[model samples]
Each structure stands twice: as structure tokens, then as C-alpha cells.
Target: MPRLADKRRAILRGALTVFAREGYTRASIDQIAREAGVSTRTIYNHVADKSALFETVIQESAARVAEAQVEAMDRHLGGAVPDLREALVAFARDHARPTDADHFALVRQIQAEVGHIPEAALDSWQDTGPRRVQRAVEAHLARFMAEGRLRTADPHRAARHLVLLAAGEVTSRSFHGALPLPAKEVDAIVEDGVEVFLRAYAP
Candidate 1:
């Protein structure tokens, strides 16, 4: 069972690499099999087809990204801070930064193939990734509201505003992770966004 689990993980990792390198339409199961160092039969045994594999990869990758973002929120907002603005800027910086090469590549692939992928897969990605990240941020903001550190009637809306303000411009300029932004530029963007967020929400 352990060996089987390891093989499945390897296949998933390999599939992600292939899918990211070659968008879903061009990625082949044989390529994934070679990258995984497993047989095509093993790949088939785990997933029904390429579509299913793609769905699995997106779901898994999205979960990871959501987890990372939530962790960033917690790290910066989980405890008391003497300077809310600074802490928020820190969180914004971390949140906007790319998680990993594979993750970034996968994001690029999603943007490239958004029209070609199944609707269900896109929905799943949204639920697992963006929505989950937003909810996590909302929960953190709600804690601040309860503590009287921030003033927002709607935590969800505030969360969305903060996220948009922090990521909107940088992400657009980066072309959804296809282009990398310089560290100094990302810091400037996050700091500016957090400043705007504080203007509206700070207590």
C-alpha cells in the first residue's frame, strides 16, 4: 500500500510538470509516464483518463497554494503586532510572492488553457484555491474586527478588497505568473496596496 501510494504521488508530480510545461491539450500521458518513471499502465490504473488526471493535478495544486496563502495570513496576522501597517505589508509581500516554480508554472498553464479545460475543473480550482484563500483571509480579518483593531462591516468584502488591492496590478503586469516581477517591485506594490487597505480599514 505504501509503495502504491508513493507511485501515485510520483505520477501526480510528474503529471504536473508535464502539464505545466506543455499545456493540457499538448501534454501526453506517455510523457507523464516517462517523467514519473512509471509505466503507462500504472498511470491508467490510477486515473481513468487524461482529463481525470488534469482535474486531479489542478485540485491538488490548488489546495497547496491555498494552504500556503492561509499560512502567510496567519503568520502575519495571527498574533498581536505593534504596527498593523507593517505587518500587513509583510503579509501582502508574502502573499503576492510565487509559492514555487512548479506552482507558478501550473498557474501559467491554467491561464493558457482556461478556455480549453473543463468547466468543472476550473470551478474546482476556484473553490480549492481562490475561494479557500479568501475565506482564510476573511477569518483572519474577522479576528481583527473582533479585537477592535480594524473596522469593517463585512469581513468577506474587506478580505476581497485587501486581496485585490495587493495582487491586482502586480498579477496583471506579470500576466498571471508568466512573467516574473522583481523583488523590489513586488515589495513596492504590496506596500502601496497595504497602505490603501489600511486607510479604509484601520481603526
Candidate 2:
């Protein structure tokens, strides 16, 4: 018999697939159960309702992605950055694309169904994922400012700008990773973005 935790994970993964493919408006518990290889009754045993399930799936998925992003931030900016531009470029490249294809598919679905999604779910997603990653970058940027590697500026704003400039172009151009861009193109975008960021925040 599968462990309870394994069943729960299977349910979430199956729910994510359905939600990503069908959006919240069209996904059904029956469909999720089929995808998850579980009985409908089993899903009900775990979640109160569809709304609760969606909330849980998105928050869990976001946390997984954010964990990777925070690690990328630390890898790129956690130590002495001899070349800020190079460091930013590397970080941006590392994070420029979706590491988890299924998660981004859900993200695309969320964007499409934002108007219909529960407010709490959306808020939880942001807090669990993007905001957490932003805070990590903000902390690193603050340290850079203190080190005089970057000109003194609003760390929060600088972090936002850095993310937008560094990774936004690729994400936007790729349509949230639905369309893949070439490596050279991705590198070009990251390089240009890092250059623009360095110019804006030069000491």
C-alpha cells in the first residue's frame, strides 16, 4: 500500500497536471482522480474541496520552485562577487528559464485563470514563490550596496529592477516558458540586462 504521504503527493501532482492543462474552470475531481491513479473518495479524504485543493497544489509547487531560486541566488550572490556584472549575468541565466516545466505550465494556467482563481490561492502562491525569491535577492543586493560594489539605492527596488531586467525579458519573450528560446538568445538577453542594471546602479 502506498503511504498516506505518497498518496497525497500523487494527488497534488495529478491535480497540478489537470489544473495546468484544463485551468481551474474546467478541471474536475474525477479528472484529477483519474490522473492521480486514485479513487475520487481518496481525493475527498485529503482535501475539503476543489478550491482548497487548488490552493494547496499551487502553494506547494511555488515553494518547490522558490527553494531552487533561493539556492540560485545564494550560489550567485552569497559570497564575494569579484565581478558584479558577471555574477548577475550568471544568476540571471541560471534562473532565466523554467527549471520545472510542469510548474510553469501551471503558472501559465494561473495567468489565464487569474480572474477566476481564489484570492487566497493567488496570494499564497506569490508569498510562497516569487516574493520569497525577491526577498532573497533583496538581501543579497543589500549586502552588495553595503560593500560599495553597488551604488547605494533602495535595495527592494534594486532587487525588483535586477530581476526584471535580468530575467524578465527571457520569461516574457518565451511566454512564461511556453516557447523555448535559443541559448545564445537567452545569453544575449541576460548580458544586455546585466549591463543595463550595472549602468543604472554603478557606484
Candidate 3:
């Protein structure tokens, strides 16, 4: 027999697919149950209601993405960055391209129907994902400032600047990965963004 945890995982996965396709207002428990290959009662046993299930799905997905981003930051920016601009460019390019398409699809769904989503769920998603990644970037910027690589300023603001200049640009152009961008265009965006960031922050 499948473990309860396994069933819950299946339900979450199925819910993500349905939500991404149907949005919060239209997604039905029956559809989610079918996608999950479980009974509607099984879903009820796992979660209290649709809102709770949506909250769990988004938070879990955000955490998974945040963990990967933190690891990427550690690998690219956490250690000895001999060339700051080069390192930033590399990191920006990596960050712009996420391996998980389904998660971003859900993000699009959220964006399309933001008003309908629960405020608490949005807060949890931001706390679990974007804010955590931003904090990681802020810590790295703080270290760079202490080392005299960047000008002395607010690490928080610097982190935001770097993110906006680099991956933020690419994400805007690519529509959060819904539209595929060519490697050359991506590289150009990263390079230009790093250059602009360095112009402002370089000591």
C-alpha cells in the first residue's frame, strides 16, 4: 500500500497541474482527485479545504525553488568570486533558467488571478521563496561590501539592484520563462545587466 505521505505528494502534484491549468476559482476538488488518482475523500482526509490545499501546494513549491536558488547562489557567489562582473553574469544566467516549468506555470496562474488567491497564502509563498532568495543575495552583497569589492551601501538595496539588473531583466523579457529566449539574447541581457550593476556598485 502507498504510504500516506506518498499519497499526499501525489495529491500535491496533481493539484499543481490542475491549478496551473484552471486557476483557483475554477479548479475543482473532483478534478484534483482525478488527476491525483485518488478519491475525493482521500483529498479531504489530506487537507481541510481547497484554500488550505492551495496554500500547501504553493508553499511547498516555493520552498523547493528557493532551495535550488540558494544552492546556486552558494555555488556561484558564495565562494571566492575573483571577477565580480563575470560571476554575476554567470549567476544571473543560471538563475534566469529554471528547470521546473510546472512551478512557473503555477506562478502565471497566480498572476492571472491574484485577487482570488488568499492573502495568507501569498504571504506564505513570498516568505518561503522569493524573500528567502533575496536574503541569500543580500548576505553575499554584504560580504562583498566588507571585502571592498562593492561600495559601502545597504546590502538589502544592493541585492535588489543586482537582482533587478540581472535576472530581473531577463525574466521580464522572457515572461517568467513562458517565452523561450535564445542563448545569445540571454547572455547579452546578463552581460549588460552586470555591466550596469558594476557601474553603480564597483568600488
User: For residues 65-133, could you state the per-residue lDDT of candidate 3 as single tens digits?
Assistant: 999989988899987889887788878888888677888888888989999999998999999999999
**Residue 82 lDDT, candidate 1, scale 0-100:** 76
After superposing candidate 3 on the true structure, give the runs of residues whose Cα lies further than 4 Å from its correct spot: none
RMSD of each: 1.6, 1.1, 1.1
How far does residue 2 in candidate 2 sit from its true spot (Å)?
A: 6.1
lDDT of 2 by residue, 81-149 (tens): 888888899999988988898899999999987999999999999999999999999999999999999
Best by lDDT: 2
TM-score of 1: 0.92
lDDT of 1 by residue, 16-36 (tens): 999989988999999999999
Task: Pick the winner on TM-score between candidates 1 and 3.
Answer: 3
Q: List the residue pairs that clash in candidate 1.
A: none
List the candidates ranked by lDDT, beginning with the highest.
2, 3, 1
Off by over 4 Å in 1: none
